[model samples]
Target: MSAFEFVFTFYSLMLGLAAANVGTGFADMWRDRRAIQVGVCAPLLAAIVLVATMNLWLRFWRSWEGVEVGPWALITLVAYALPLVFLSRAMFPGAGSTTSLEDHFFQHRRVMLAALAATPGFSLIWYAAQGTLMPDWPNAWLAIRFFAPLALMALTGRTANRLGLALILVWMLVGLFR
Candidate 1:
């Protein structure tokens, strides 16, 4: 496989790992009783995001490896990418119990579902920034990935999120150096 294939494969795994972390973060928050809503919602959302991201990523990676995007691959690719676009913003931090109730969606459900759906849009940003070229794409994409740091801080709490962001940046730097 080419370096692009290898690097993107690693990046895809990284995204999966990040998604898992998101689930764990929410689970932890829920366990701590800090955000019951996040705890209840985050794990499920994370799984969807992870599955979808992985599916889309595999298709792209296969194509990068010079494989054709066949029917199955195309199906998975679409299944993953489009949902991720809006799902990114789901379960945002600002919504407390007073802000949204489960039944609220029937009347203005889309409006009520805002917080739980923000993350997917950001996921789209991350994916798009990854680009379609080689060598230059992923590396260049890291620069744009910077936008995620603040959101991470907010979602995970400033101190812990900062550390996590720093760690991810460090990992990205190592990949660049490699």
Candidate 2:
């Protein structure tokens, strides 16, 4: 196998597991809908995680396909993938519990947001290590556009978190067209 393929095989599996985790979480909520209060926040978070995992998979192919894979690349890739898995797992309560999805979301919000916010920085570092070319923007507005609202949401109330998530979804949608 080519070097990228060799490394990507493992990465693909991780992403698949992340996606599956999100799907299963959603399914569990559906199956228990009669007993469970399926709330907005957790489902929204699941959507973000699922879409982000798919984006990461596409990014791996687009950015890393021709790049040389080494020990550090493997290490960084693992670091990147684990938080995604954690975020996926956090999207729902454990196998059996009576907590509502909203309660589960608030209970895990800090860790969930932390994991969500971390990936962009890790992506930057991974690309830097690989000498991948990044876009040069005017005044670093792009970075601020993401990190600022997330930081606000992480430190503020529920309203801010909802707003931040809306912003993130908008950004993701905008990114798709770019």
Q: Which candidate achieves the best TM-score against the true structure?
A: 2
lDDT of each: 0.43, 0.74
lDDT of 2: 0.74
Give lDDT tens digits, candidate 2, residues 39-98. Answer: 777777888777777767776788664657788778877887888898898778887899
Off by over 4 Å in 1: 1-3, 6-21, 34-42, 67-90, 94-178
> Each candidate's TM vs. the true structure?
0.35, 0.84
| lDDT, candidate 1, 133-171, per-residue tens | 334754344433334433443453434433543554444
lDDT of 1 at 157: 41
Error of 2 at 175 (Å): 2.0
Model 2: lowest-lDDT 10 consecutive positions: 137-146
What lDDT score goes with residue 107 in model 2?
Answer: 79
Best by lDDT: 2
